[model samples]
Target: MSFLRSLSPLRAWRDLRRFLALRKPHEIGFMVISFAVTGTILFALYKDAAIPPTYKRDVLYVESWPLSRTDREIIDQQKADLIAEKKRAAELRARQLKRQAEFKRLDDRLERLGI
Candidate 1:
């Protein structure tokens, strides 16, 4: 039964031919152009898919002094300076808050004395 059903290539081809024959000329032209464009795009992509490997020099030489203890010390000093600046900023904020509180107290005292 399945073999008989599978042997329908003639019917399929006939249906396909009938469908194509019924299609308008403009519709057929557009379909052909779309297929050609898709095929060309796929071919272009397949052709350019490979990347060539690159070569590099195996030997290297130093013309100047590499990183030393002094470089590390300089980096450490910069980090310490940043930390100190942050601490100074925090202290200044605390001082400003204290000054604001003192000013509020003075204003209250002056208002109480009516002066």
Candidate 2:
């Protein structure tokens, strides 16, 4: 019986009214803004958690070529891959050499300063 009385809608509304009545308008505005921000964040999190993804997965790194490619095509692809790999290696090597040169120059400067 006591639990049922506590659950009454009229009492709940009265309590809510009393609580709101005690709050300043600016406090209520801040509370409303806080609730809006919190609700927006929760909604965004819920959307991000959805199954089957609302957007495509990050840059799918699968082969775009057909499975029944010709042998010559495969050889060409291998050649292209080797060329690209060599190009990247050459670029990285150049960068490394430049960095080493800079460090050597700094070392020589420090040696001249006798530090």
Candidate 3:
């Protein structure tokens, strides 16, 4: 009980009061800057919460229509182009892999021949 009495709330309050009273100009400036930054962050968060996302405004829950014949033909043409491009890419990748394997085989043969 005596030890607890020695470290009382009143003493801590007084110490905190004295520390605040003894703040220098630079310390006061830093404290003001920190408060301003925290206020700006809180204001930004408030603004963000008030506004809805752009996607919700533009696209979400919007009605869609089925394609017309011309639109469907255009989409089919685009799909065929994409499939051709993918096939070309796969062929290029296979050729690259084969070239790499051939280089490795030649390197191994050169090493075996001590050259």
Best by TM-score: 2
Cα lDDT tens digits for candidate 2, 23-92: 9999999999999999999999999887573333546477889988999999999999999889978987
| Local lDDT at 112 for model 3 | 100
Q: Which residues of candidate 2, in runs, are more than 4 Å off?
A: 1-60
TM-score (C-alpha) between model 2 and the true structure: 0.45
For residues 22-106, what per-residue lDDT tens digits would candidate 3 score against the true structure?
9998998999899999999999999989986533233447545455658777789789979988997898789889989999999
Give the alpha-carbon lDDT of every model: 0.86, 0.90, 0.86
TM-score of each: 0.40, 0.45, 0.36
For candidate 1, which ten residues in a row score worst on lDDT?
Answer: 53-62
Backbone clash pairs for candidate 3 read: none
- When 2 and 3 are scored with TM-score, the better candidate is 2
- Scored against the true structure, residue 59 in model 2 reaches a CA lDDT of 65
For model 3, the superposed segments whose C-alpha errors exceed 4 Å read 1-69
On a 0 to 100 scale, what is the lDDT of residue 110 in model 3? 100
Whose TM-score is higher: candidate 1's or candidate 3's? 1
Model 1: per-residue Cα lDDT at residue 96: 82
